[model samples]
Target: MGSPICPDCYDYLGHVVWQYHAPELWRRAIQDVSRQLAARLGVPVSKVSKVVSRQYGRTAEMQARGAVHFHALFRLDGPLDEGIGAACGVGVDVMVEAIEAAFSRAQVQAPPTFECDQSRVLRWGEQIDIRIVREGSRTDDPDAPITGEQVAAYLAKYSTKDTSLAVPDGAHVHRIKQTCAEVHEAAILRAESRRAGEEVPVPVDSEGRDHYVLIGKWAKELGYRGHYSSKSRCYSVTYRTLRRRRARFQQVTKSRCYSVTYRTLRRRRARFQQVMQEETERAQRAGKPVDLAAVEEALLSQEDESETSVVIGVWEFVGVGWTNQGEVEIATAAAARAREYAQLRAGKQ
Candidate 1:
């Protein structure tokens, strides 16, 4: 079950606009972090590159209240040669302080809406958390610092998070979609007026304007118009680069990087599906019933390895979902169970 919505009126326009500009806000926030880091380390802003470089991996999550939260892993490294090792001089406490100051300094002047008739200042929320990622397993101490794998897992889990919210009476999830539609209608009228050369009074912010029309296009996402996950250019290998590498590169390279890579997880998923099919086929040939639990255990016990294989077969498109009503019912029941489990876990969080 989702969280209960409040009875009070919500500024739907402001909410959507803030969600629309979240990417820009994050960009400016990171810049502020760099400035803060420079000040903390007594280095000039322009010369900070010579001393250290800042890199981050971020994933955006939507709260049950329909607000965006970011889980980011920020690291400071030396200029070019010393690598992440040089960051030891700055320490985690300084990073935490820089993050706090950055959050305070980061603000975006949102576009004016019909309801408010003035530009709004959007800032990060008060609930801030900073964690130090240690190199190895955590100690038995209750306050032991978390490991890199723990941090990466936290980000990976939330990057695929379920989103649900409804404003007004807060009874149905469709209410948020309805709100997006209403906002879209107003924006359409405003655009029409501008095209006809009529004077449409829209407040102009000193920073500039944002396109509000995207709210309707992303209505299913409750007006969030930004990426679910992003990272700095130097943080890790990008998907485009990885795809290029997979095509022509015949060698394996080693480099210090994030513990989790989305591309690797995707490849593992395809491999898992292939293994399951093989196991089922083997069981069928022996005239034996398939044991799903045993198959899962076998997969988990095996090491993560893959080989180059020749795939010579005629493949066909499979239906997106169950092909029959009986199977549909079973799938629906399974989905309901999964949703309930997710709700339980969310409550624990």
Candidate 2:
């Protein structure tokens, strides 16, 4: 759960940048480890069985000082059954060596640094911990239950998280906002370190909006949005495909079309509808007659029945559109005209 970072010494931009690349770094590290194992065993990368199947995994914020580090969990297919043990050998010393080697060699370059300092570096934290699977064991203990599920879950969770000033979500909005403000106030803090910079952290809870307002510095991220994960093509199925399959199955079961579209729909005359509903309720309570005004109000108070009522505005880049009161009024008027025309036709009949 810890990376080699001197909280007092590490650069803030470096910390934020690392958070941005952590997912890629982890993937590369795992791939390198697999390659190392394959080379040692004299087998193909595909042949070596992945003991842990990462159904889900995440990364979380690990802070040293104002700087950030990482703690990750990776889920596997099963417990460390055979391939990992055979690859790393029997003792924990061998496991540690293999892990260290993979992490040490694994490097992610920053985009073409022209500066004299050239921050494009390849270094992992010195604080490396490797453990084997054992139930009811401590995380620090080398024999803890590092199950496939445990690793995947751990990595997946933190994959989308950063330090206090990293990103925004419902659970930690207050803390994130406060930290962002602090970082903003400190001139010592680098631009990237101030707030998630390029990396966008997703919320642990999926039901809520990916809000960035509570943590304003994150507005630069275009709404706390970024790629939360990076996996090799060989890893497994994708989330989108998985969801599509589930939806297809549901559609088939329900005997409906599987196609779906995401578009903006406007409902106009909402206020008028509300007023009509209220009046109807009052009439019911008073045992009064429900007449033409009530019926017309209810019918005309909707966009589907009248096009001119609500004005819908769309922002192409942002992909959002909504209706205002003016549009609602126009649509209501149109609905009333249609009703009048219908009544005229009925009179002629």
Candidate 3:
């Protein structure tokens, strides 16, 4: 379920309220909505262990209307009490009803404006979108269920987007600019009032300090103040954990700093072939078949032990690829020789 602030709240906050205070108002409204939802679901605030809930918030802008809105994902685990209703858990229909009821009941008191008092009630817009996410389908697909991957990717895409309003000529841009100008004018008025030792029209905090003077600071965002992305603590894995896991993987797979010369490689290959030949000869002399699996396992164990041995040498860098056509022919001849050797070893086995 997604809900956007009403037009009246939008205009009042963007034009009349200070930008610094806008975030606080938004936080209050979101909390109110959450509280209402919890109340509807019969979840106690003090005892949160009964129901596990996760929420993620995404702030987005409408290109045509140039207004900012929120997109949120709510995952509810259970009602837990089987005695209340069905055997497994709460029904999808009941959850949807709770969402709608919460949205309707959620309201915030708007700050006083020049034309009106502070008693005005602000609520969500009429256009509330509610969609049930089921397993194995998408929100747009009515026949299929919603997959976890799809929902995660959808929310992540919106979370990383720029929250700035779109560029378009017309009343939307004009109104945004006009509201910013109003904020600036209010700042100037507050400053002048302070200098003259007269009362300011803007409200003050408990400390008796003017709070609306910082409204012009967030004019770039059209006074829509909120984080681009927010989530509950238990919603997902932390970035630090992911980075640490990656670091550990890299450490495990990182190659040791050692140099290998062409001569060394040839020597190792020759030693391997000689060992295999000796083993085959021994098996024939004993009139017994060679155990290929045992031979492979022994070779692997030897390799693992040899990995810790330090090879001390400084080799000059040779140019990549075959230096000449003769070198390429030589490489091909060596590969053919290796293949012949392998075939001979296979026949012996």
Candidate 4:
């Protein structure tokens, strides 16, 4: 797909610059989409935003032609309790029109690479897919709608996907990597030259972001520098909030996917029995009576020796994951099985 007729006609510089500013382009597109909605609804831009809101999740993937592609799911929602929702008038047809028009008009300029001083025009590819997601089985129609669950699961899978394997090895891919490295080196020189009072074009954006200063770091990513997946801020709560509320109080059950199983209770009981026996034997040896309440408290308040150890070293934040290898393996296996089952169900649907 890398120019089936003439590969040399492809603009490698434009491709990389577009890849780098992909996020900004998407942001501008969303703004344009809002404006389009406002115009269509005959409402002011400022007031429309207050009534209609858009929440979306975007994931980037490597196309067969070594270019970048975005698969986004936009959800038109309203204020939580403000009662100013899409129920007022907006529908799926309006959303589709707005999004298509927005992307077609969305454009962001990219700074010139070190090798070339020519400005680059960054925008999405001509090919874009906008589909309506609903909850139902597929029909015999060629353009049948998809289920929300399917889109969610698909995007979620791609969000964490590694594109290295998905990208085909070719001269086009290698050239993109080379362009990233060259652009990065050029940016460093430009920054240094500007600091030395030289007449170098400024590479900073309006927000002072050195757009391609670290382009070389992502050379392995085929010149793409944006996040593989992202969601709107209002789309959901912070991960910190999720981690804080990971556990919820539920009735003790002997069976369930994420519930406390009977084996877990059996293990706790076994540990409690051992602790009670040890304390009783110690009390008997000292010719003292064993308090039942004290035994129960001891069992409940059980702590590791490390927990009571002196704090001599400073603590630092580390990346998140399972606490041990066993948990990691268990989680990995469960995730693999879940993915397989999900695929099977999707096929059936």
Predicted model with the maximum TM-score: 4
Clashes of each: 0, 37, 3, 0
TM-score for each predicted model, relative to the true structure: 0.63, 0.39, 0.55, 0.64
lDDT by residue for model 2 (45-164), tens: 776554321222333354423233445433333323331212222344434455567888998864311112234564677776656544542365444466655665567656655544
- Candidate 1 residue-wise lDDT, 146-232, digit = tens: 888778778878876665422322543366667778877777777777777777777433443325655689877777778989888
For residues 190-237, what per-residue lDDT tens digits would candidate 3 score against the true structure? Answer: 667777988655566566644545556656666655565666544454
Off by over 4 Å in 3: 1-26, 37-43, 78-88, 113-120, 137-150, 160-171, 191-196, 206-211, 243-349
For model 4, what is the C-alpha lDDT against the true structure? 0.72
lDDT per residue for candidate 4 within 173-247, as digits (tens), equals 887888888888888887777678777665676665456787888788777777888877656654654553352
**How do these models rank on TM-score, best leading?**
4, 1, 3, 2
**Pairs with steric clashes in candidate 4:** none
lDDT against the true structure, per candidate, is 0.71, 0.46, 0.56, 0.72
Q: What is the Cα-based TM-score of model 1?
A: 0.63
Off by over 4 Å in 1: 1-5, 80-88, 138-142, 164-172, 204-210, 249-349
Worst 10 residues of 1 by lDDT: 247-256
| Cα lDDT over the full model 3 | 0.56
Pairs with backbone N, CA or C atoms under 3 Å apart (clashes), candidate 1: none
